[model samples]
Target: MESWLEKRWARPLYLAFVFCLALGLLQAIKLYLRRQRLLRELRHFPAPPTHWFYGHQKLLQDGKMEKLEEFVEKYPCAFPCWVGPFQAFFYVYDPDYAKTFLSRTDPKSKFLYKFLMPCLGKGLVSLDGPEWFQHRHLVTPAFSFNTLKSYVDVMTQSVNIMLGKWEEICGTRDTGVEVFEHISLMTLDILLKCAFSQETNCQINSNHDTYVKAMFDSSKITFYHLYSFLHHHDIIFKFSPEGHRLQEISEVLQQYAEKVIRDRKKSLKDIKNQDNAQKKNYPDFLDILLSAQAENCDSFSDTDLQSEVNTFILAGHDTTAGGISWLLYHLALNPEHQEKCRDEIRSILGDGSSITWDQLSEMSYTTMCIKESLRLAPPIQSISRELSKPITFPDGHSLPAGITVVLSIWGLHHNPAIWEEPKVFDPLRFSLENSDQRHSYSFLPFSAGPRDCIGQHFAMVELKVAIALILLHFKVTPDPTRPLIFLPQVILKPQNGVHLYLKKLSK
Candidate 1:
């Protein structure tokens, strides 16, 4: 009996030792192969290096936009180069190349955007082919003209809440106030009211607290994933602190979203039982989303519903909020321009309690201001596309499959070749006569073509209403102490926030 037991234990121990030895050897081989590949790649395209084996890492670490621009300009057409064993892109600034890659119909988005797959899942933005088509069809109805009009009251109420808060804080007189945080909160409230019928006050509170803090952490994690080693295909999340934080935030945010979704679903179920004809009394976007059930019901799933809710919350709140913040910041800096915008608002509404759809259409100058603000400080600063199939641009340069391309707003918007005096803030450039002479893609703040922003109409309405109300109440002036600086992160935000004084205008 003793001899048999010893024999069994001996075999198992030997196998375990062999397994350990094999793993170590495999790791060593992988390291050697990676080093060889890096050296081979470096010979063709030489990347600038840093001392101490850092190799262009400091530039990445700094995250300064100017430094990044310099890096882009160093290479031909601002293409990003790799460093050492890890393959990472630096910058891509060619417009022809951008159109070729981005316009391609493929699942090529996965290569560069692997980091977002976990957070966004297989939602419309992250999908391709039939799955993307089906999902987009189902969700598009939520943002339709009639559907959007239903939420106008919610938008008005949210804006009213913001104006009231601003009045209370600034004491109904000429007082210095930063508008970024207020705009951010106002947009958040509008999104919540329209999308989910929930509300949270984030303006008066330290803009750096709680929700904003969580978002900051998440954005950092997003930036960290730019390195190829930290990509989705690899299990690098296990070793990364940023990845861990991303996961934690995902859990926290999803829980919050799920709670709201559950409540909205319950409310819709109750409403459905009462009356099928009472469509006008529907709750909000959540109600429409829940009721979007089709006869086939094949396109919709529990996962799809969850993903849609998360997408709505993020996109609805962030993009509009960012645009509004930029508009406010610009208005604060240029009081003469602000006066022009106010005059336009007054001409259209004439002290009306709310801006009707017809009146919103008449505010052409206000629209021009918003357009120029977007052109200068577009909320989505960059968009990426990875080449899935070999394609030649209009310039005749062929991009090989499996390379990434980017349409850089930083470069494109500021290009003097496209816009004469591009640095100047001129809303009149958007006038029918002026814009008709420019290229369609030259001033695409909401982008162009099929992949452009879907919520643009909704956002425009919200901004027009909010700006009209704010202009009716106060005259914005920049605080001499705090100059505005654009801090580009996930969105273009003010570094110190938009600090300005408000003078109460006649009601």
Candidate 2:
């Protein structure tokens, strides 16, 4: 009886040990497989030096773009280059490969967009397939010309406020102003007035200005996501300082948006109780979004509403400012071109007047100048796409699936084959007569196809109004000492911030 009991107990213990041993071996195998895949992906890449443990993390600490330009230029059209052990990417300097990647809406090409996922959410920029189609459809109406027109009075109001401040300063001496900072606030004011129906003049804040600080914090996080390939992975992001700051800023902005949305909803409810055309009178984007929400109760949640607000605020504010600043920089350097645009603006609107959208559109020379500025200094400098299936390029080189390809805007714009005398600032290239002869995919400042910028029309309107207002009051001359230095951010902006001597024009 004792011997039988011993054998029974031993049998159970032995089985338990075997099971544990099997699990241990399986885990070890899984880890080994993961490392092996990382190694294999990295082996095909152009090798950068790494520490014994951390890999190429240090190379991406700062000045990432400067290093990346060197890599892209050196390789030209190489596939699957390593930033570190975790990433294997492709760089496409060739126009043909770039076109294929940018135009395709396939599932594979969509994965390269994962970088934008955390910051932008699965918004239109990050989404693919059915989700993308649905979101794109729902959002298209918000950017229509009629909807945009409702916001013009607000844009004009904001510009007048900015110009008032500028006039105060420039009255005494030749005010050497940093135009980027001025333009930045002008667009911010426009976004606030249009989207949230609030006025936030961030240029001169009485308080410590937490809102603008949060905005800069959010912007820094976006900049980090764009270029830091190795740290862009989920694991590294969780531990980053910027990552923590992003969460905080997101919370702050979310709360602020919720308050505005809630207030708007309450106002609409009150209007409904009263009845008639009073409710329909409100024309701001906030009113439009709230109206849509009321009609389609099942469509979007508070999260979605907040995200759209954030997207518009960020997109509308920076892009328009970047466009105007670069245009001024180009015009400042080229006085003949400056005179041409001024002459055109003067001819169309005359002095001491406001511009309507139709009037702005009719100013052909001004439009050409804006188009040319976008060509040379595109606000969004590079776009990245991934390959899902192995694809062959026009040059007959093959790129395997899962490698990222960066479309170099600077390279493409500078390519002599595409544009005549590509370096010179010539708005004439975009004139109606010359536009027909231009290549279809050559000029992609706002990008091309369905995924291009939604706020472009709004941007153009804001630019025209601001530019017209500035020119009416002040004639900008570059200080002879400070020639414009090209400092590239997410937008190609002036480094010294377009220091110009503003002589107030007599009425």
Candidate 3:
């Protein structure tokens, strides 16, 4: 009787196992069909040969840039790039296509950019629709020309500090210094002073500062999360080591922002302190945020404050540093253009004095070279958006609603069809006569449209100030021994750090 009972139970268990196996097979077949439907929908766009399961991931594993360029050359306007069997997006490089897509009011790609929301906290970079509009409207005044003009002094001081450090390094070492490291810290210093009026001396104490270290770590972790397929799921990533580390880093960043807000709020409670703050040359970004909060506590909460603060801190410093580093690298590689830019800067700021607001516009050639550098190596190589409505490109290609489109800024800038000898670093391309003749969307380092970078003006002013001061003080040349390999992360960072020899010029 016991043997008979065991046999009956085992039969049920075996049946249950078979049932589950069939169910799983059905789900797999469903998923495969859905992917095939997507592929058919994208049939109008050509793609490189892809594996049945791995897609383009294997092809992109080595020499990603070269493969991308190859695709660009073979395809016209846009092509579908599959990340896996189930995921794909059109890699759009044509200026006309970019202009058409960017002109729309589509939200950012939820699948791609949502990864940043945990780190950035729904700031301008991630927000959409009414909420994004509200936040943007509230913060717009902080980046006004008057406020940016007041920031010039702060930028000058920060640049001078970096240049001083380089001076000391030049005295002792005949070798090239890794500029990206110093530039990153200096940009962080500048952002701190301009954003919060706080001086942490990060450039000097960089190795020891936990906040600075956390900031860099957060960027790396975010980039990792973006590319790791297994970590795409929230629950899976939360249990992983990177996720745990990211959580810790997030807490550190949150704590830092909170402390600054708390201190500023406490000081503002004092009437004397408020009066003094009002009497200052101009209020910093934090002051403006606080003022906005005081006016509309219901609209702008502490959470919003923290998000914007963290967003500005991370986005501001890193991107600006990349732009400055690449611009200097390009200038180093092309000394003739570098010398011409120096002459323009020298003419604007005689005796190598502080770069003033009015003089910034006078450095026309310098500005052109900066634009050229941005074109060749845009800090943010690509941006993505999800279509809310079906749209047809100028070339008669169309994409349905809900499709994700990646605007390849790097590809657009380097397209031979849009530019003559695109790889050549020629600043004349940005000259007024030449610029007016080219497509407006051909060069978009800061991107284009309503969602373009809000801090672009602030970034431009900072770039001009830093480049002017550096050019005035040193003759920069590329380190022949350590060639740069472009690596696209959160920004287009060099795989190896940007190494340049800085020879201090006699005053």
| TM-score, every prediction | 0.84, 0.83, 0.95
Model 1 lDDT tens row, 1-507: 999999989999999999999999998799677655545533434455543344454554444666555544564444444432444443445555545545667453454456665555567667777877777777788888887777777788878887888888887678878777677778877776777776565544636445445644555466556533434435666467777778877776677667887776676677789885445443576666667754335768767777777666666666787788778778877778889988888877788586666778888988999998888788877766665677666765555565555567766676665667766889999999998987666665666555667778988988888888888888777777888776665556566877878877766
| Candidate 1 residue runs with Cα over 4 Å from true position | 1-57, 68-76, 81-85, 199-217, 227-236, 239-241, 276-283
**Please, what is the whole-model Cα lDDT of each candidate in the order they appear?**
0.68, 0.69, 0.87
Model 2 worst lDDT run, 10 consecutive residues: 108-117
Q: How do the residues 1-507 of candidate 2 rate in per-residue lDDT, one tens digit apiece?
A: 999999989999999999999999998788567556756654544544455444544544443555544554555454344454445445555566667767776552343345434445556666677866766677777888988776666777888888888898899567788777777877887888888777565766714666666765565566665456645666787678877777777667777778888887787778778884464433776666666666666866666666677777866666788888888777877888777777778887787456666777777787888889988777777666666677777776666676667666765676666677777898899877898886677787776665677778888888878877777777787777887666555555555676777778777
In terms of lDDT, the best-performing candidate is 3
Query: Where in model 3 is the C-alpha error above 4 Å?
Result: 1-23, 59-63, 172-174, 271-279
Task: Tell me the tens digit of each residue's lDDT in model 3 across 1-507.
Answer: 999999989999999999999999998899788788778889988888988777776654332786787788889898988777777878899999999999998999986677777778878988999999999999898899999999999999999999999998897445589999999999999999888899899999899988899877776777677666567689999998989988888888888898999998887777565576555566899999988988989999999988998888888888899999999999999999999998888877986666778989898999999999999988888999999999999978788897889999888988888899888999999999999999999999988899888999999999999999999999899999998888777677778899999988887
List candidate 2 stretches off by more than 4 Å: 1-81, 107-119, 233-236, 276-282, 480-496
Kindly indicate the candidate among 1 and 3 with the higher TM-score: 3
lDDT assessment of candidate 3 = 0.87
* Ranked candidates, highest TM-score first: 3, 1, 2
